[model samples]
Target: MKDVQKVLDWVVAEVGVPGIVAEVKDGGRSWFGTAGVADLETGAPRQQGECLHTGSSGKAFTAATILALEAEGRLSLDDTVEQWLPGALNVNGYDGNTITIRHLLSNTSGLFSTGLAPEVAQRYATRAGFRRHRFDAYTLQDMLKLAVSQPPVGAPGERFTYANGGFHLAGAIIEAVTGNSYADEVETRVIQPLGLADTYVRPAADISYPDPHPKAYSKMFFKDGTDLATLTAENWESLLEDPGLAPMDVTEVNSSGAWSAGNIISTTSDMIRLVDALAAGTLLPPAQHRHMWTTVSTEGGYWMPHARYGLGLFEFDKQATGGTPLRGVAGSLWGSWFFAIGTADGRHTMAVHTNTEWKSWDVLFKLIHAAFGLTIGA
Candidate 1:
């Protein structure tokens, strides 16, 4: 335990991580702790129970929602994207009607990165005028529109290209099949059912920090190689407007751009609940859950042993520190590093969330190493 604390301290003092909340559970029992400041300017210390934005980690939630729908017989994984959303996809040189839901889930939809698109940049520019406003008001339609305008990078199911557009399309599919908004469906089916009271698909009405919140900051580098520290609050709106950019405003990004791809905000406790539930077949049945863990072979036909994409979660063969072979999903945005790890049977689960950006990955590697009783840098 002392060694784990030492790693946390090193993150705060040396790596400039602002705050962290860590929890480790074995056989459903657990221990948790925090270090450093949540709000650096106020010197407010970090605490447990605060919600941190789980970027691509929401991919797991979206995938779970899809499986839940499948369980209800509302849709089939083999169903084509155009079957539900009807004319919603408009990629150049590709027949959008032929792309299957599985293609979207597996990231083989052939959609390009939304960040590299020209019209997306223009739409974000239009929305930038409302920087001071709350983000909860943005509709899922806004995201779908952005996705439909991009060109396909390849034929459906041809390759693995990580695209926010794919998940955005998935969110649209959820809306089309259920006749409910993506946010509402997730809350009803996943969040409320699991009793994850602290977890939410959107921020609170006032954009107020939930209990045990952490402040986020980012280092922006200029084209000339000059960089400056900017409070995340100032640029968060712009960040949310563009999924291609790192979000400084966790709320806006989660609510608007990241949506189904990376919008879920949760605590370490809630994250563990999610992982445990998913592994236990609570949210998805055994076969579907197994499907979620399936990995795609890369275009080069080489699969990295340490990382593979499950339905929405990522399965890692070993911790970054190379301790105790494990499987888990990791999420990052401008100011947070979120991770959840355990064995295939959910016998042991560990989760960590840090407030600082940029350095959390390094800290995660070190912490996981320490958790397995291995020396750092050994």
Candidate 2:
């Protein structure tokens, strides 16, 4: 077997990352590996079995929860937003009747994104802002209010634009329909059933992870240009340089900022199981699993080339099988990145995440290639 631990170390070293923990699983067999340091001062090595923020990678879990409700006949994808939250449509003049649950899940709702709001973006995007409000508490209503107050990226059922509020809104509907917290629903519907002991949705305003986790780090960027792909080497260097404060330890940043949208703390072992089930249509009915991949072109090549957005899932031009796309999901929020991919036949799965934020695209592709032995264009 290839020494994946050594390969992980090489990837971390090459990318200037703090640490990485990964899980590779196939059928009943699995391997855990790690590299680099979890804490810079203590030089604590990253562990293979530590919780890392899954970010939007948690979107699949959220989607799964909703789909499970659908399977139970509690709700339908065609249900309107106003059915769950009546006045929410008043946000930015959106017509709730026109926006369906599937639209929210599919990223076709074109809602204004709370994460893009200047205040929300600044809190985690800048060195000064990170120091000030890294742990400040915000509420779910706050994010929805921000979304409704701003103009949307596009009209409902229009072009695809990633929006955090869409998933947040989905969580709102889940709570209204089920009379249970989104976290609880997910836990009962998915986590408990799978016996995934290491996975959980973080409570709003709560930022702490359980034991065994790398201290998360985020680059403090004051401003970003119009295009992320066009970001120059100098820009990367500047972002990497010590700001007024060095890289921020954002492990405890307010989880409410992501809420049910992405605020899930989990391990690669748990995620591998989650992603494998998602790949194999075990999380949702076989008929519904295809719905998550009814992809529409995001036309966001500048950010991720050939990127296509589906119901809480994403497909890129470089994945295995040219476009067979039921493979996996990847996500990043502030200072954490993680992913899970399953083979076409659903026998093998690989999951990974980084404590360090950004600067690891090449390594992600390399890791996928190394683990899957498939030249997936990362």
Candidate 3:
């Protein structure tokens, strides 16, 4: 099998993904690699140990905290979200009282996900728009209001629509149950226990990534007249293959639009640690652990192909038949497209990311194929 560094360099040179970093670990042995530029202006190369926003990848931590509290008999997944947060779900044609904690985690809550909405998504989706509001402050309430304006995907448990609003609502439940901030609970339960010093759930106002990190770049274009929201992976793949567009330097944007939904920051090494612990059942007890792993098919290919969402972590099985599972959470925010994958046994973990925005999910799949020697479909 090709080594990680060789493949990483190939990706940068041949595949045109800027500033990539990756790591694979098994049996206490590991390999790390980096390629492309960290800062396009300074021409600094990407490196290991530099922090990147993990995006929705941090939702796994949020999910773990909720499960830990449940293990302590503090709450139940079946508990109505309305029971905890009353008026927060005033979204069009939706009732928070009918949604459960499980619904939120599994992304069956049907809430409108503002993370993908035109008003919010367009702000950072294009070079022109991205440069306009890269440092704008977006409050949690401001984001939720967007979801509130949109309609639900379906009745709770009847459909799967991944929503940032749902997870932030989940974080609110965490605060309500624990009487501590969401960051505090995760710090005590996951970060401190695992000795992951680099991991942190960034607040809405914080607009900086950690030191030595690569600047993220992004591409934004469409076949003139195409609806931005309806642009699928097929069209996006075509756009990248025939690039008559400019990519944006998106290194310093605030993550407040994602907030608790996807605003955590950490390195690839620490991400592997988090994935290993979660998969090995070290983070949650047997019962809660099983609950966390009980995944439901996403049943759509808008973002990921053949995807499934578990409690917090998500996975994608590339084949129609049972293929190797790329199990871990992936995050897409600004210029980062990251995935931290592990096996069912919690061993043999690999994480890879390209510090470029709007790269296809295929970038993640190919990195997994390289790191683990697994076959991935087109």
Candidate 4:
């Protein structure tokens, strides 16, 4: 436990992250560790387990909800988008008949990510614009319209490209099939059944994190040429400290842009439960569960290295985890980054988060090594 604590402390003291919290479950025991201040101004320490804006991590839940609906014979993975939501994807080179729910979940839909759109990026990716329109509400229709406004990346199932817009359309299909909101469907199917008490989807208008949550921050990397993929921990210290790039508090922004894709808020403990259930096949029958793990290869230099994306989940190669294959989700948004990874059996797991948008996959690799090595079998 102390060893993991050291890594958490190092993240804040050396990596320049404002705050970080993590929860790891090994067999019958669980450990929670936190470092730095949740509110940078007040210097308030981050709680051991606190709610955070868990961006695209919500895709796991949204996808699982769809799978569970399929198991109930309400839908099918091979169902065409046009069957449920006609004409929604028929614009801008996207043909609804060629795309399937599986394509959306596996990121094989080739749809353009609406978050990358200039108008949309300005709202949350720039400091001044974020301050101006932080609380504006965007309906589901607004998100889908933003998707079709841009050209499709490729034909459906051509390759994997991370598209939050695909999941937004998935959420829309969930509504079309069940006649209930995506949030309610996910809650009833996944959240309630698994008893994930601390996990809940934020409404489009709700900007604040629930009480006992960390204050979120962002560096406003909204420019077209901005890329942090190649940066290392050495680069973050000076980069985050730069006057023009100092992290700003963005805890009060509406997340409708990422709704159904990234708007889920959760604590580390609850997130672990959610992922564990998905990994353990607790929510779906065996056949449907098999479908959940059927994966599509992500293009090189595009998504995670050697990670094959499954339905709503990522199965990272052993290279990323030091040896054992890890299945989980890593999601980031305006002001937060969240990760939850575990073994196939779900016996060993880790969920971690930072309250700032500055993310280095290299730093996460080291943290994953440190947390799992000392704690898993001890």
For TM-score, the strongest prediction is 4
Task: Report the error of model 2 at residue 43, Å.
Answer: 0.9
Distance (Å) between predicted and true CA of 16, model 4?
1.1
Candidate 4 global Cα RMSD: 4.2
Q: Candidate 3 — which pairs collide?
A: 38-215
Model 1 stretches astray by more than 4 angstroms: 115-138, 203-206, 220-254, 297-305, 318-325, 358-360, 373-378
Give the poorly placed runs of model 3, Cα more than 4 Å off.
Answer: 1-3, 221-242, 318-326
- Tens digits of per-residue lDDT, candidate 3, 123-179, equal 655555667888888765676677667777688888677787788888889999989
> Candidate 1 has which clashing residue pairs, if any?
236-249, 292-311
- The best candidate in terms of lDDT: 4
CA lDDT of each candidate? 0.67, 0.74, 0.77, 0.80
Using all chains and alpha carbons, the TM-scores for the candidates as numbered come to 0.80, 0.89, 0.90, 0.91
Give the worst 10-residue stretch by lDDT in candidate 2.
Answer: 225-234
**Candidate 2 lDDT, 1-378, residue by residue in tens:** 275666688877776678887788877888888888898789999877787888888788788888889988999989999888898876566888888899888777868655556666556555666678778876878867766666766777887667778888899899999999988999999899888999888877577888888898876465433333333323434444354345667777777767767888888888877777776777778767877767777664123444566677666544433654436777887778888877645689888888866564677667766776655542
User: What is candidate 4's lDDT per residue for 323-366, written digit by digit as tens?
Assistant: 57678888887778898988778888899999886466655666
lDDT ranking, high to low:
4, 3, 2, 1
Q: Which segments of model 2 are wrong by more than 4 Å? A: 1-7, 223-245, 301-303, 316-320, 323-326
Candidate 2 C-alpha error for residue 339, in Å: 1.1
The C-alpha RMSD of each candidate to the native structure, in angstroms, is: 6.1, 3.7, 2.8, 4.2
After TM-score superposition, the amount by which residue 237's alpha carbon in candidate 3 deviates from its true location, in angstroms, is 7.6
> What's model 4's overall lDDT?
0.80
Q: Which is better, 1 or 3, measured by lDDT?
A: 3
